[model samples]
Structures are given as C-alpha cells and as structure tokens.
Target: MGRLFWKFFFFIWLAQLTTIAAVSTTFWLEHRAQEERLAQLGRNPPPSPELRPDGRPFPPGRFLRPGGPPRPGFPFVPVVPLVATLLASLIFAALLAWYFSKPIRNLRSAFEAVVNGDLAVRLGPVMGKRSDELADLGRNFDRMASHLSTLIDGQRRLLHDVSHELRSPLARLQAAIGLARQQPEKLESSLGRIERESERMDKLVGELLTLSRLEAGVMGAMDETISMDELVSDVVADARFEAEYIGRTVQYSGRGEALVKGNAELLHRALENVVRNALRHTPEGGMVALEVHLDASGNDVRFAVLDQGPGVPEKELNAIFEPFMRGESSQYNDGHGLGLAIARRVVEAHGGRIRAANRAGGGLCVEIVLPATCG
Candidate 1:
C-alpha cells in the first residue's frame, strides 16, 4: 500500500493494458479487412456468377460464397475478448505488484524497529522458506544486529567491571588519607599505604588502556621480525628471579629461533602475561615450566606454559580468557583478572591463537601460537 506498491502496480497495469490494446486492435483491423473483401465480392458478383449450362445465377448465393456457410456478420468481435483481457490483466497486475512489494514493506518495518533501538527484531522467521536475494539480505541484517547487540552488551559489562575494579583502591586511598588526618604520629605508614594504593590504581588503569587499544585493533607500524625463542627466554629469565624470590622455580625449554613478524613489545608483553599468570597460580616450591617449539605444521610458533595449580573448570576454560574472569579457587582470586584477557587479545590481534586446558597431571597449561615467518 506504499508508494512503491503503487508504482509497481501502475507500471505493470499500463504494460498489460498496452499489450491488450495492441493485440485487440490487430485482430479487429484484420476482421474488418476480411469483411470488406467479402462485401466487395458481393457487389462485383464474383466476375459473372457461375452458370452451369442454364444455371440461372447458380441458385443465387452458392456461387458468391464457396466452402462452409458465411460467418454471420463477423461474430468474432474484439470487444468481448478485450473486456475479458482487461479484467484478467487488472487482477494479475495487482497480484504481481503485491508480490514484489510485500517483502520490501517488511524490510522497511524491520528497519524502523532497528532505528527505534530494537536489536532483537529478526526477519528470518517472518520470511518463511523464501530463498532469494531479499531473504539473504534479511539474514545479513540479522547477523549485523546480533553482532551490534553483543558488542554493546560487552561494552556495558566492561564499564561495570572497570568501575568495580577501581572502587577498591580508591576507597583504600581515601581511608589512608583519613587515617593520616586522624593520627599525625602514624603519618608515614598512612602515606605508604596511600602510595601503594595509588600504584595499584595506576597499574589497573594502564592495563585497562592497553586492553582497550588491543580490542580496538590499534596496531601501529608493527614491522619487526621477532624471534619467539628469544622472547620466551627473556620472559623466563625475568620470571626466574621472581619465582626464586617467592621460593618457586621457573624452568624453560625451547628449540629453534621460531621467527614471527609483529611488534616485539606486544608479543613480549603477551608472553610475559601468560608466564606470570602461571607463576602466580603455582604453589610455593612448585615449578612453572615454559616450553617453546614449532607446531606440527611448522608454520607457527607455539609457546606452552604449564603450572602446578588448581586447574580451571571445563566450562570456564574458555571464559577465563574473557576480561575480568577469575578462577573460583582462593589462590586464583588475587589479581584483577585481566592478565589472560589482555594476553589473549594481543595474541589474536597478531593473527595468533591462545587457549588453556587442564593438564592431566594436575595443573593448567596455556598455549599461545603465532604465525611464523617462512624461510
């Protein structure tokens, strides 16, 4: 019933009417010409009426008209057939117009709903079993809407988590200031507490900014070819000092240079995060093992970190890489839980894959794979 429908109807009806008129006119003109020919023959008497040896004009009418009886004053008039065709064309044109415009109307309605902030509106079910370009368009729209809904939901969740994470340090900073005001004698301790809380806040904010940049895919001029084995060795060396300080141990095993093309800083940070995360979960006196090797295909470098800790649940293995997701174990609840998330994002940004699984021998193993530069 919209303008489009009317346009289609008008054009289709006009075309059908034009065709009907042309066909009708052709048939009518031909019939009129035939009638004229017959009348002319009657006037001329067919060049001397046939005479069969004293025939006397051959019974008056038989000589004038041969074959069957006359057509009885042109019974095949175009008026009746033209009228029937008009009616049929009107019906068919309306139907064809509706068929083309109905899906368009539905699409318009769906667009309006989306503009009104309704992301859940779907056109697939309404389209039934139709398999056409319009139906494909509807499916694409559904996918886009679904992706937008998920992104918006994730942004909202990230905002909430950031606020929650910052609140604790902020509250502690305020409390430390108040304590310093109340007890001038313990000003030094209060100031130290404030400094610690401020550092924690700064670290959290820096991690958040890095996570945002990674999520936005903001890689700037990363044209460096980094050796994976060297990076892992550097991370393991740094982790060894920390592990020794905490009465734990860091063991490293690697082979081959395993060259990859990316930003060295980001790749190093990702590897560090994964290693430190394992070290944090690992118990004192336990060993965190880091291993680097080429995968079976020899097209990518794989870094595996195995830790002796309470493994994540089967369901949470995938979720652990999500921002601010922490394990349920008491030992796993210390940090803000962005380490693995940031690591995952960084690896993914560089066209890599990262995953974690529970070790059969009672621990967790995290693996990071990056595309290797071909020789």
Candidate 2:
C-alpha cells in the first residue's frame, strides 16, 4: 500500500511538472520575441509619430521600449500570458489528477464490499475501453464475483436437499413408532425396518450436520487439532480390522507427518466415509489402499483412497459430489451418496480440494487434499 501511494504521487507530480515546463517554455519564447522587436524599434523610436505609415495616429505607448522607458512614470507592463499559462497548467493538472484517480476509487469501493462479505459485488459497468489492463481487471473481478455466487448457491442447494431428505425419514420414523403400539406382532418387523431406516437416517443427518459446520467454520464441541498420523492411522486400523473380518484387505500407508488444522472428530468422519466408500465398491478379491502424501499442486497434505472397483462414467465425475447423488447403484451396494459430498465439504473448509476419477486399471480413485501449514 505504501508503495502504491508513492507511485501515484510521483506520477501526478511528473504530469504537473511537464505541463508547467511546457507552458513556461512557450511563455519564455513569446516574451523573447516581443523583447527583440521592442529593442529594434527603440533604437530609432519609430521615426516620430509623423513618420508612421498609417494615416491614423498610433497609441502613445506603441513605440515605447519592450519593458517601457525605465522611467518613474510608465504604466506597469501586464504579465498576461504568463498568468494565463500558469492558470492553464493548473486546469490541466486538475483534469489529469481526476482522470487517474477515478479508477482507483472504484477499485477501493469494490474491495470494501468484498471485505464486508458482499462477495457478489463486482466492478462491472466500468466506463472504459476493454483493451487495457483495467478492463481485464474489471472482467476478472466480475468472474470472481460470479464464481463466489455460484459456490454460495451450490451450498444453499446442498443444505436444502439435506434438510428435505432428513425431514421425510424423521416423519416416517415418528409415524412408524406410533403405529407399533396398536399392532405389536405385525408392527414388530415393520418397526425393525423402521428402526434400521431411522438409524440410517440418523447417520446421514449427523454426517450432513458435520459437513455444514465444517463448511461454515463453526467450532464443534470436542473439536481439537490432532496429529495427521494419529487420525489416519486410527481410521485405517479400525477399517482394516473390519475389512479383514469381512474377507477383504484394507492396505494403507501414511508415513511422514502431514499437518492440518481442523476438528479431529469431523475430519475422522470425513476420512472414514472416503475409506468406506472405496471398501464398499471394491470387490472381494480387490484391494483398497489409503495413501497419504504431500500434494505438490496445492503444497498441502493429500490423503487419497483408491479402490479397485467398477469405475464410474466420465460424465458423473463432478456430479458425484452433490448431496444424495450416489452413482448408479448395484445389488451389492446399498450406497447413500452423502459420503463424497461430506468429504468435499470437510476438505474445502481447510482450503483444500477433493476429486474422483477412474483409474487406469479399471477402478475408482478418490483423492483428498488439505492445505498445508508452512513450518
């Protein structure tokens, strides 16, 4: 900021200096010419008034020396052009200053709006040609504003979808419990299914709640910063045991500390889903690998979960992040699509990115990257 201040100040000073110099040079030249003419005429005093070529008489002071006869009783010679030139320079300086300051003023205003949380505010409709860097700046601001608006809109939609899904299951659970009293035998199995459904809904609701809090950056109770090795290792150990018991393998490696600042519980949940997502899709003979490495692109820690399962179509790569957008289902998969959505939200909260893609050897790869703190 200090640098910018001096840069503009110097520019304005230069402009004013140039204008003054040009005006002073013009005045000096005109004055020198007038003085030479006056000096030549004074050597002869114009031959006397009768020697004048015009029939009409000339002004009394027309034949006087350039600066008047250095006598005590001559009218003062007016510095009209010099004063006019100075005035002109003042006008030019004022106009140049205004032309240069207007764009800067607009930029400051837009920056203030951004600081005030009006991410949608943009420097549009700026009165200028679209050929200069300022035009590019205006366009860039507009683009940034547009992207922020889209992200906000996406979040709002995700919230609405989550709320709507949770409400329906909750209402059904309430109704099912009420009916369980009237038909004990018949409602037993129904209640069991309802109980299971209610549990699933409860889990889904909890995951969504965590995702929301992460995205909003609200502090959840019992949340604290923990070591990356501890978190990832715990999840892998627990999941690996379960996979082994289920006749599958959960191979993993997270050597070298990958530091991140976040809620341990929420991050655990996020990581759990990513690992489970791969495990669920992977075949019995197939293996799921949870690998942690430094993300070169983001200069952050990356925790990637790769699965050797049937890959998704290319068209569904990004769409899979939407809430409740589970990829095409199979009889073997009772998939609820909130896993990737929650993963994405949690990672983004830490200024990170997550993505999914098909692997070369016919499988799916999900990568989670969290921003790294420079040590």
Candidate 3:
C-alpha cells in the first residue's frame, strides 16, 4: 500500500482501539465490584427464590403482586453487541480514512510528475468535481506549472535568437579581416568595417544586459519624483535631432504637468527607447508624434508615440514586445530588436502597462500608461 493507506490504517486503528479499551475497562471494573460484594456477604449470602406450584420459580414478579427491589450486583454486559459495535466502527474509520487519503495521494503523484520534468501535467481533471481546499491546491499547481513552462520555453527561444544574431556580424568581421590580410593597400577600409561590426556587437551586448536586469526587477532606485512633461520633451528633442538626419520630423504635443514616483533614469530610458524606435521606422519626410497626457480621472499618466510608418500585423502587435521579436516592416531596419522589450520590462517594474496598436488611417501607435502621483 501507499503512504495514504498506511497513515489511514494506523490512525483509524488507534482510535478504534482506544474506544474498545475504554468500554472493556468500564465493564471489567463493574464485574470486579460485584465479586467483592459477594465475598463480603460470606458463603450463605441469601436464600434461593421460592418455586411456584407449577415449578416456574413464582414467575419472579407479577403485575398484581409487587416484587422486591433488584439485588445489588454487576449487570450483564453483552460481548456479542460490543464486538459488533467495534467491528462497525473499524469499518467506518477505514472508509473515512480512504476518503481523505485519496485526494492527497493524487496530489503527491502530480507533484512527482512535475519534478520529473512534465510541465504539462495538470491536476484539475484528475481531481474531478470537488469544492474543497485540496481542489484549490490542485488548480494552483496547474497554474504554476503552466507559467514555468512558458518561461522555460521563452528562455530557450531567446538563446537561439541570440546565437543566430551574433553569427552574422561575427562572420562579416572575419571576412573583413581576411580581406585586409590579402590586400595590404585596402587595410584602412577593412579596419573601418571591423570597427563598425565591433561596435554593433557591443551595442547588442549592452542592450541584452539591460534587458536581463529589467527582467530581474532591478529598477535602480525610486526615491525621486519624475516630471512626465519634461521627460517627454527631452526624449522628443533628442529623437528629433536624430530624425532630421533621415529627413523625418519628431513632434511633441501635450498639456498639464504629469508627475509620477519612480526612478528618473529608468523612466527616461524607457521613454527614450520608445521614441527612438518610432523615429527609426518613420520614412523620410514622415512625421513621428509624441503625446503625454493624463486620463479623464487624472489617476493615470498616458504617453502615446505615433509613427507614420507601415504598422505591424494585427496579430503581431503584442508579440513585438517579446525579446528579439521584430515585425515584417522592421526586418530591414538596423536595430537589435530589444528596445521595445526593455521598455516593456521597465514599465512593468514601475507598475505600468505598455501596448501597441495600429493608428486609424495608417502607421502604429504605442501607448504607455502609468499610475500618477498625487503631488
């Protein structure tokens, strides 16, 4: 038998044994008292009852003739009834034990399966229809398992992508080095190519480190009050300078002072990444707009970045926030694909949400919503 069976057997058996022992002790003590009383009365205690003429012992007592009080002695205890009651109690305890142990056994088995690397293992259906705490435990286990499975899978994919992205730049750098060795006259040009690739790799690695820290919930410090208006203005001014190089313009429009409590450096980086991403996608002569506003209830600060470029597919809007995920339009863009992902993690660390959607006429709109501070 399993652990449940042994546990139930021992506990139930002990309880039944206690009950039988108490009953037996009570009966035995009464019998001993009666024996003591008889001994005290001596050998010829009392005369035998008188017999009737018909030889029926005067029928003991009759309705018409009242009989004397019953003799002071131990009452008879029925061994058969006692044995029957004990037997019935044992059976009931065994059934009760099984009822409780069955669910616990199933949970243990499910936990074992999870330990054995079966992330898909669930206990809901196995538990059937039950409205107890054990059932809730089972459901929670399934949810935890599901979440772990997702995280593991995502990590695997990220590793694969990182390796793939690194290979292309490394290969180009190697080829450039080979050319420089073959042609000494073109060494300067080859060195330029090598430097660019090295810088690209450096940027990729830096972004990856930032993403990892954000994912690990390291948001620096939150001891400062950030001005949302100034933050957006700084990001837009910097992006606009960069956008001008590609014939694109960055515009900023909003009203009122929106303040929040968070790390100023992190908030600035998060908003800057978003604004720069919009500027990168907007085509030459196109416009990228940044808007900061408070919701109607004034409880939330909202920042929206709208880009006049080919928006992503509807189904992929949410997926773009995942690490190293890029849309079709972004395939030709020169980016490490971790900007939005890092932005998302930073926002989440500050108890905020970021989402992307296609604008009405065209282009894409990315929105960030944060809880506003009272002061």
Candidate 4:
C-alpha cells in the first residue's frame, strides 16, 4: 500500500480502537459493581417495615420485581451500529490516503527519471492545475532540471571542442618529429618546429588548467584589497610595451581610485587577458584604450577596454565568452580561443560580470564590472 493509504488506515483504525476499548471497559466495570451488590444482598436478612395505618405498602411497586432489585450489568451499546461506523471511517481514511499520495507518487517518478539522466522529464503536466505545495514543488523541479540539462549540454560541447583543438597541435608535433627522423642533416630546423609546437601545447594545457580551477572555484582564499586603478595601469603598461613593439598604442584613462577585495593575481590576469585580446585584434598604428571608473553610487567599479579592430558580429556577442567559441574575425587568428573564456571565469569568481559589445564607431568594447570596496 502507498504511504498515504497506510497512514490514513492506521490513524482511523487507532481512533476507532481506542473508542471501542473505552466503552467496553466502562461496561465491564459497571457489571462488576452490580454483581458485588447482588452478592451482598443475598447475605443480609431484610428487616420488616412498619405497617401503614391502612395496611398498604408505602412504596407499592418498589418490591414488586422478581429478585430484590434487578441485578446491574453491562448496558446495551448498539454493537451493530458501532461496527458500521468504524467500517465507514476505515473506508474514508483509505480514500484520503490515496488522494494525498497520488501527486507525491508522480513527483517521485519524475525525480527517478531525472536521476537516470532523463533531463527532459517534467512534472508540470502530471501535477495538473492544483494550487498547493506539491504543485509548486513540481514547477521548481522542472526549472531545476532544465538548468541542469543546459549545463550538461554545455560541458559536452566543451569537451568535444577541447578534443578537436588538441588534435591539430598533436598532428603537427608528430609530423615535425617524423621530418626530423627522416632528415638528420636538418634536424636542428625540425627540432625548432617541435619546440614551438611543444610550447604551444604547454600554453594550451596551462590555460585549460586555469579555466578548470576557476570554474571549480578552487582559487586560493582572497584576503587582499586591490586598487582597481593601479591594477589596470599595470596591465595597460604591459600591453603598451607589447603594442609599441608591434607599432600599436595602448592607453589607460581613469577618474577615481577604484578599490575592491579579491585575489590580486586573479584580477590582474583577468584584466591582462582582455587587454591582450584587444591588442591582438587592433591593427598596427591603432589604439587600444583601457578605462576604469566607479559608478555614480561608488558601489561598483567599471573597467572598459576598447580596440580599433573589426568587432565581433552582433549575433555572436555572448558566444565569445564560452570556451573555444570564436567569432568570425577571430577564427582566422592564431589564438587558442580561450582568452575571453578564462577572463570571464576569473571575473565571475571575483563577483564581477564581463561583457563584450561592438563600439559605435568601430572595433569591440569589453567591459568588466566589480563591486567596489566601501570607503
């Protein structure tokens, strides 16, 4: 039997049982007292009453019954009616149990399906249009399942992309090794190719590790107060050095000092990745600008990086933050396509949001918003 059925059955049964026991006990006690009184009457001799003036009995009908007084015993308790009532109660309890347990059973089944990897399972239709806690639970379960399914799908896609990415470099590395073995005289040149490929592989692995850690929330404890302005300046300075070498320009502009509490290393890396990405796309002699300022309320600090290169397509603005997701313009570049993804993870870990949008005039603008430390 279902839980509701048993619960109702037992409850109703116990109540009826208690009522019957009480009634039976009271009847038995009254019977026993009456029996004791009869025995005492049998042992005692009755004293004759004084004759009335008219020689008539004072209480004429009092002694008219056959035994001295009718012996007291159990009272009639309508056993048939009591039994019928109990049976009815039992039936009603069963019905109530079934009614309450039906929805719960449906929810359990849906949960089981989800546990078995059936993400499409939902309980909304099963729950029907009832306004109760059970119905609310069904709705919440569907929402949770939908979210979990999305995350799982994203992870699967990420794995596929990662495998595809790893294969290309591996093939090149193997070919370079084969060439070195075949041409011993040009081993040095072949080894140079091998070294470059190895370095590329190492960088890719390191970035993957970093991304994993960020996503897993494995960063070390953050206890440092970071000056956002200074951090941005440092990243911009490094980008500027590289930009100057390539005939491009990097500039930093800020209003007030923006301070926040977080891991300085992670914040720096996040900013550096964004700046470097912009520098990579910005054409030679173009400018990549970095701006930092606090919001009007001073509760949040905003960092904006704008590049003078071809911006991403309007439709793919959000896709760029996903792992291995590259825009049309970036597809032809020599990047590993994980820079923006890592930057996003880092910023999110620090309780911030990063977004990219196309600048009005030209190029792409990336923004980072972090909660500022209160003065």
TM-score of each: 0.85, 0.62, 0.86, 0.78
Model 1 misplacement above 4 A: 18-81
lDDT tens digits, residue span 1-375, model 3 = 577777887798788889888988988797777566656656332255545457775444211123332333335668898889878887888787877788888888888988998888888998899888988988998899999999999999999989988998999999999999999999999999999999999999999999998888776888678899988888878898899887999888997899999988888989998988888788889999988899999999999999998888998999989988887656445787899999999889888999999998889999999999976
What are the lDDT figures for the candidates, one per model? 0.85, 0.73, 0.85, 0.84
How far residue 42's Cα lies from its native spot in candidate 1, in Å, is: 14
Colliding pairs, model 1 = none
Name the lDDT of candidate 4.
Answer: 0.84
Candidate 3 Cα outliers beyond 4 Å, as residue runs:
16-68, 71-74, 78-81, 328-333
lDDT of 2 by residue, 58-85 (tens): 4565334343332222333446855776
Query: lDDT tens string, model 4, 199-302?
Result: 98899899999999998899897878999878887897899889999899988889998899989998888889889889888887899998899999999999
Candidate 1 lDDT, tens digit per residue, 120-219?
A: 9998998889898988988988898899899988888889989999999999999999999999999999999999988988889999989988888886
Instruction: Give the lDDT of residue 192 in candidate 2.
Output: 83
Best by TM-score: 3
Model 4 segments more than 4 A misplaced: 1-4, 12-92
